[model samples]
Target: MKTWSSIILAGGMSRRMGSSKALLEINVQTMVELLVEVLTPFSRKIIIVSNEKDYEYISSLFQQALHVQIVTDDPLYQGEGPLAGIYTGMKELQDSWYFVCACDMVKLHPNYLVGLQERLHTEIVTKRQQYDAFIPYSEGRVQPLAGLYSQQKETIKKLLDQNKHRITEWLTHMNYYRIEPSEWQGWTPISDVFFNMNKPEDYLQICRERGK
Candidate 1:
């Protein structure tokens, strides 16, 4: 019911995967393409933040199929990490709420994301100033990328200005609502939804799952 924008952080070095994970495929579609498809219905705008070199390659794949805006990290914050990607996206888009995701996530659950948006909107209507972010917590770790951020431009900029680019560190200073894994039990298994491909083994695992 709440309209928001989405930012896919595909700028990772992927050193562990030894290749661009965004380009990795599931059923012949790149990871970025699949993520864009999953997010298109929920987002008013979709932004893909990637490195300059990979921008062209990624664009070539989706420029025609989807109406997405692909951008490189701000020159000022190049190579700063996912926090910089979030800052760049929030600064570029006018949306008050943003759903940030990592490109490595192969099985994104739309229901889970929609549920987060619902929770965020409910809080906005009831306790507006209580939270700036709605993130998920699973296996005792907060999933920053798979979260929604609100009015984050200035706050994120402050962190970037201070040279503090860690997302977890930045979260400590904001009023954030954490959605526990228990909250998503009915929609899908937490492990399947949050599984991110960081290495060859992880990718292979997803491939094997798909074959089942």
Candidate 2:
């Protein structure tokens, strides 16, 4: 398997949910905890990006966990959104590739991640250099957060320096490998795979679906 690290962005305001969504419980596990569990099987290094206050709380929860790093946004780019989190993680780990996702993601399909890793390995071996990322594209939307990124420290740093913080717009300018919905059919519905608990209603919906 190709070597890689992961970043979990947990610094959102959570205004819609009216509370820290990263700490929200689903299936008896906090959202952040569940995400760590899901990614632990795939990568040895996992970074959780949050604010200083949240970082303390999150770090306490995993004091004994191996290879988990809880980090606050880089001081220079504080509050710059997920793009900053990605940039910070890339700078910290300096890994060849990274898998980034949000804390609000309710389900992460391991099988699909394995498939993505395989595809990334092929791209590396074939010297496919046109793209710097491998992201999911479905229903006319690109899921930037739940994708794999090649070393993009400089690209991300340039965007942060220019005060352009929109992740989707940044993605548009980069050459990326798009994993179409059809490619994810057998593992799970694409919608479910990318399901995000962005609001109270969304959280309730997940609870209901899970028979909670």
TM-score of each: 0.93, 0.93
lDDT (C-alpha) at residue 190 in model 1: 50
Task: Report the Cα lDDT for candidate 2.
Answer: 0.86
TM-score: model 1 vs. ground truth: 0.93
Local distance difference test values of all predictions, in order: 0.85, 0.86
* Model 1 lDDT at residue 17: 100
Per-residue lDDT of model 1, residues 31-120, tens digit only: 999999889888988889998879999888776755588889888899999999998898887788889999998989887777776787
Q: Please, what's the RMSD in Å of model 2?
A: 1.6
Query: Mind giving the per-residue lDDT tens digits that candidate 2 earns over 78-162?
Result: 9889999999999988688899999998877777788787778788889857568899876688889889988888988998899
Which whole-number lDDT from 0 to 100 does residue 63 have in model 1? 61
After superposing candidate 2, which stretches have Cα over 4 Å from the reference? 128-130, 187-191
